[model samples]
Target: MPTPDFVLALREHVGHDLLWMPGVTAFVLDADRQHMLAVRRADTGAWTPVTGIIDPGEEPASAAVREVAEEAGVDCAPLRLVDVRTHPPLTFPNGDHAQFLDLCFVCEHTGGEPYPADGENTEARWFPLEDPPPMNDRFLAQLQIVLADRPEARFRR
Candidate 1:
């Protein structure tokens, strides 16, 4: 995972202190609706939809598109906004702390096969949505919200 330069600079100032971050997650589904592309994170070996931090000056939707390409080697078009959510604070193994405001999106697969294009993922592949590897509540919720195809975006106050 490439840490944005700004985040690296911020860490220089605050070390492991908590920082609020903006991020994006992509639920990349297949045309058949049976499988979705996801990554098994290299760090924790946990499965997650394509996700990455939003760079400074970058649009959230753009970040979601970029994450899908960079993490899964797939091209996609944002079909709809899924949700805007604030996740609980987290601390990495190295003790860096952060809270995230995540923008989730559903992307229609445009082209390319799925693979782990970046080092952050051990593997990237399409998984059956009905039996996705156990994931956090937020991820499952986003999956449900996106799958529903509701006209309105899911929001967290």
Candidate 2:
């Protein structure tokens, strides 16, 4: 299957000049703490947390807020930094090669209903913590770390 335009652009940029750096991922929780907001990637069908690449001039916290709004159409106030992770350098299917340092924050949803804001995501829904959507082991591990009372954990460099 052909890669999506965004992926293609990412690959091209990374393959040539741009270098991907630290990014932020958000695990947004509802007021009742019964649900967590997640987004389904259109390209990979992976039900993952809301995340985005931190722009050059942007702070990681601000990036987290922006990404949550962009990917999940929700306003959130990040409660605290939860976990920091690093993905090994690898070439994406679209041919982009780069390493990612992910800063995962746990945030509380402040406003707006969950919905896909744009091309970044296809579906946004509140998932019960007890019966979360299918996700990779890495993501599950990160979620566990965030839910734990510890300050933060680092993994997979």
Candidate 3:
């Protein structure tokens, strides 16, 4: 996948000084509660929820909404914060090492259908929440926790 122009510039200018910012990811559930919006990432083909790094001056919830719109062409309202996770410091394929604190929000889809927003995603689809495609273990675990009646279960590092 091609890096966004802004991200490429940030890496070039900041080099190792680039920091991992906290981000918010949204699992947008349809009104009927039968489907969840997900994207097929062009880079990895990894099926994941709408996600993006929080802008320097943006709040997590707002980032979630903006990412959903930008990535999936959908408008959403955060229903509740489902999980807050901090991944161990790691490097991306491009050798950028950083730690990410991710706030996963359960969101209600307010408008728009699934449409891949150009470079950000290759495909966007509404998958049955009950039978999501295989995903990373971390995300699958988080989804299980969020789906349970108790949405506040915490995962320890």
Give the winner by lDDT.
1
Write the number of the candidate with greater lDDT, choosing between 2 and 3.
3
- lDDT tens digits, residues 1-157, model 2? 2333554566555554334567888988899888889999987889998877877678888899998998888999988887877777776555456677889888899999999888867899999988888989877887787667476555545
Q: Which candidate would rank higher by TM-score, 2 or 3?
A: 3
Error of 3 at 81 (Å): 0.7
lDDT of the candidates, in the order given: 0.88, 0.80, 0.82
- For candidate 1, lDDT tens digit of each residue in 1-157? 6677999999999999999999999998888878888899998898999988999899888899998999889999888788998889998888999999888888878899989998999899888988887788878888889879899998866
Q: Which residue pairs collide in model 3, if any?
A: none
Highest TM-score scorer: 1
- What's each prediction's TM-score? 0.92, 0.84, 0.87
Ranking by TM-score: 1, 3, 2
In candidate 2, which residue ranges exceed 4 Å CA deviation?
1-20, 152-157
Candidate 1 Cα lDDT to native:
0.88
Q: After superposing candidate 1 on the true structure, give the runs of residues whose Cα lies further than 4 Å from its correct spot.
A: none
TM-score of candidate 3 to 2 decimals: 0.87
Which candidate do you rate higher for TM-score, 1 or 2?
Answer: 1
Error of 2 at 143 (Å): 1.0
